[model samples]
Target: MDKDLERFVEYCKIDTQSNDTSDATPSEAKELNLTKLLYKQLKEMGLEAEIDQYGRLYSKLPGEKGLDVIGLNSHVDTALEVSGKNVKPQLISSYEGGVIKLNDEYSMSPSDFPRLKNYIGSDLIVTSGDTLLGGDDKAGVSIIMEVISYYVSHPEEKHHPIAILFTPDEEIGRGPEHFDAKKFGADYAYTVDGADVDMIEDENFNAAHADIVIEGVSIHPGEAKGKMINALRLCNEFDASLDPDAKPEYTSGREGFNHLMAMNGTAEKASMHYIIRNHDMDLLQKQKDEFVSIKHRLEAKYPKAKINLDIVDDYKNMHEVFLKDPRAVEHADEVFASLGITARHEPIRGGTDGATFSFNGCPTPNLGTGSYNHHGRFEYLSVKDYRKMIEIVKAIVKA
Candidate 1:
């Protein structure tokens, strides 16, 4: 196995799934283990490293004066949909454009995903069709590690000062809650969390969450007709109110999505969790307004139903800052084109640690990790693409 992919698989085995329910800054206890492990590795590489009380880990490599410090940030948290613990990564020697069987029950086939053709001659690492491979950001972390190791081994290479930061609870959208941007001390940064080899994202969705609560009167089943109202029925109606075409599965590219995550109800009460997302800020506000109008209409129909709707704004597009300063995006594109990789500019349908960092202070952009079908059994990364990413980093630092 190549050194970077080897290190990535090792890190994946050490689960770091974050908990959103915890009040702690990291939001999970397991996150500390990865932080501590990274601290040791950084110290071994002869860099000053520290893990703050909140489980944020930072490391520094000093360089010549007058050279600006560049930061590389990656979150150590994994998505909560699958088991991150005891992840067994399967390595395919070389892609031959066929299905890869994971167990008796599941397989990843080229017929289902045509992108597999892009990896016809590359090495691939995947999961066992039972658990996730955790490549979402661990691949990012591994890339950072390899770059640091390269610089440490090649002292003659001309480079500026570098900062390494590992954040926690990124999967749960709280990675930047306690991030000290000033303390990070970098003029700009990049989050290696994208899923393609040539993707450089400066735009992300304007996000907001909504929680709908409905109350209904319960009566004996024999006399339930007209005397009792079912909250579950109301909840179903609420779910159907959103445009069917605006769902994750239906939308693609720059199109928006309105996700009705979950609903639980009985005759007495019902509640739903919904998240609204769109790239344009104006459209995002309009989506929220539509939701509010729907709730009001439902309330008017059932006077005593007592429906409550709560909407909370989450994050905004980083393109505002990117437009203000186009140097970073332009420079990255120039370097990527020079390296023979086509730079693809696209809006992120989801959020990233870079979005929060960009809004807070730094104009951070999300770079590619070369992984596909993240947070599932079919997750995989191209070894060739991963190595090309390291070259992209070198080009950025050298420029």
Candidate 2:
């Protein structure tokens, strides 16, 4: 456990923040820093490891032939919202409660995040406020690595064949762009990238993205009247036409939202990016339809303005795939029972790389990494829970 935590800390220090703007498969060249390290570590374990051209690391451990070939996956990249470089993680033990300060400027409290109270008696790894802790999926990677290390050291222990995948660009939704179901060769898999250790994710939001561009006539302010069509003003009006309550800040659990991700414009031209999400297909369609409705409404309102709205499907709910083949969830239930752990099936508020893998053929459900408040400075990992999840994975593959 100590050695695995050491690996996690070492990984946290490396900057692996993915770039959404970059057209590269891994998104950022720096992402290969961690990928290379993981590749070397996996090789040290005496397993067959290789990195694909897309920057994904695949490794395998031979087990009993009769058992199913299981797969484990996690991403190495950190969120782009905060800096992941030069992360100084703080190790806190014997917590007596109250506020835990990340730094002078930032502190985490139960008042703001009630989940802090759950880790009252456990050890924690937190950020130093200048950057995010990167536990979102790194902890996931650590858990998988620990499981592999265990079987490697104890070759006598019988278990299922394990296929490992460490991906890059997950923070930007490109983690599964290079996924190969045949190459991994697993009957089922799990993406260890969730918050709590006591929950399993079986469903995720059906997602789509809308790119809106508005063109208008730019006239001098002195002659501006009905003749002057400000594209920026139209952008504001277009966003304002959407339902005020149907936004990310206002909704949660089962409720869909239309999130305005980015907006930029001038008097003659403007563009807005929105991500539409919902657990239900019908509701997601409504959200997409609403975008078109607003566009047409605005077009009628402004005859001189030209609005080009493009909506593309990002990913679908993995629940549909799971419905056809539920062995992944069923096996997880058995593993939890064997370990005397009670984990509930919950829908992930966000998507994981598992969603894409599931649609492709592998019904990959998601598990937790014992981390909380991801993609921000206040992010933390419960060391006690982290250790526990390692045990859970070991039991899952036991032969």
By lDDT, the best candidate is 2
Against the unseen true structure, what C-alpha lDDT does each candidate score? 0.84, 0.91
* Candidate 1 regions with alpha-carbon error over 4 angstroms: 103-105, 217-230, 236-241
Best by TM-score: 2
Q: List all candidate RMSDs to the true structure.
A: 2.5, 2.2
Residue range 57-156, candidate 2, lDDT tens digits: 9999999998889999999999999999899999988676889988889998989988878888888999999999999789999899999999999999
Q: What is the C-alpha RMSD, rounded to one decimal, of candidate 1?
A: 2.5
Candidate 1 residue 268 Cα shift, in angstroms, is 3.8
Compute each candidate's TM-score over C-alphas. Answer: 0.90, 0.92
Q: Per-residue lDDT for 78-169 in model 1, tens only?
A: 88888888899988887888988987898988889888888897889988877888888888888888888888888888787888899989
